[model samples]
Target: MRGKKLADLNVMERIAQEDDMGTMTKDESAQFKADRQAAQAKYGQMSAEEKAAVRKAAQQKRLSDLNTMERVGQENDMRRYMSY
Candidate 1:
């Protein structure tokens, strides 16, 4: 895994890349901080209904992404088992 490129990593591998704070690179941490600040700024100006909508949309997107990641993980597992 040390010499592998990001493109070569499967979904699970990519996700595991940021498993903990100690594993996160400085650039990744900076980008994550910037993104969070931007999201907070955007949310701060929204009306009540707009905030609710945004929250709901965020939840849905999170769930969808998790489902997709899970499916990819399952596919990877199946492939590994099939090679046995």
Candidate 2:
């Protein structure tokens, strides 16, 4: 049996494999990141559904942190308004 070629992998899988390879030098990694950033910057936009999904995830994360913030703020308020 023959082994599969690296080029045969899909985009996401190829990126993952590159990540696994661990051979990319710091300069190469920087260039790859810059290229990706430039590509995203040029006429980069998300669909309504994608935007909604991101917003929903962010809202969910914020909701998870709400209780922690409320506790901290309540504690601060109690200390600020404390009577001697």
Candidate 3:
């Protein structure tokens, strides 16, 4: 379990693994803790529609970022080929 890759676990399992590991990095762990606490505090005040909108926006941003990364990767590959 100690040496297991995160890719091998499902979401819940990966969360469990992270919890078991306890310290990902001091700064990261503290930031995550703060973020979770903030989200939890804010979530209770949000309406259902607001939560849905936030989720949708987050998903769209994630997809947009992924597409941008793919395009950049393709451009880098082309540049490498041209240079060679």
**What TM-score would each prediction reach against the true structure?**
0.42, 0.31, 0.43
* Residues 1-84, model 2: lDDT tens digits: 026578777787777766754588999999999999986775258777776676667655655566876857666554433332
- Each model's lDDT comes to 0.76, 0.67, 0.72
By TM-score rank, best first, the candidates go 3, 1, 2
lDDT of 3 at 32: 94
Steric clashes per prediction:
0, 0, 0
Higher-scoring candidate on TM-score, 2 or 3? 3
Greater-lDDT candidate between 1 and 3: 1
Q: What is the lDDT of residue 19 in candidate 3?
A: 72
In candidate 1, position 10 carries an lDDT of: 89
C-alpha displacement of 11 in model 2, angstroms? 56
CA deviation > 4 Å runs, candidate 2: 1-44, 68-84
**For model 3, how does the per-residue alpha-carbon lDDT over 1-84 read when each residue is reduced to its tens digit?**
656677777788877766744448888989999999998989889999898777777655654666666767766554443332
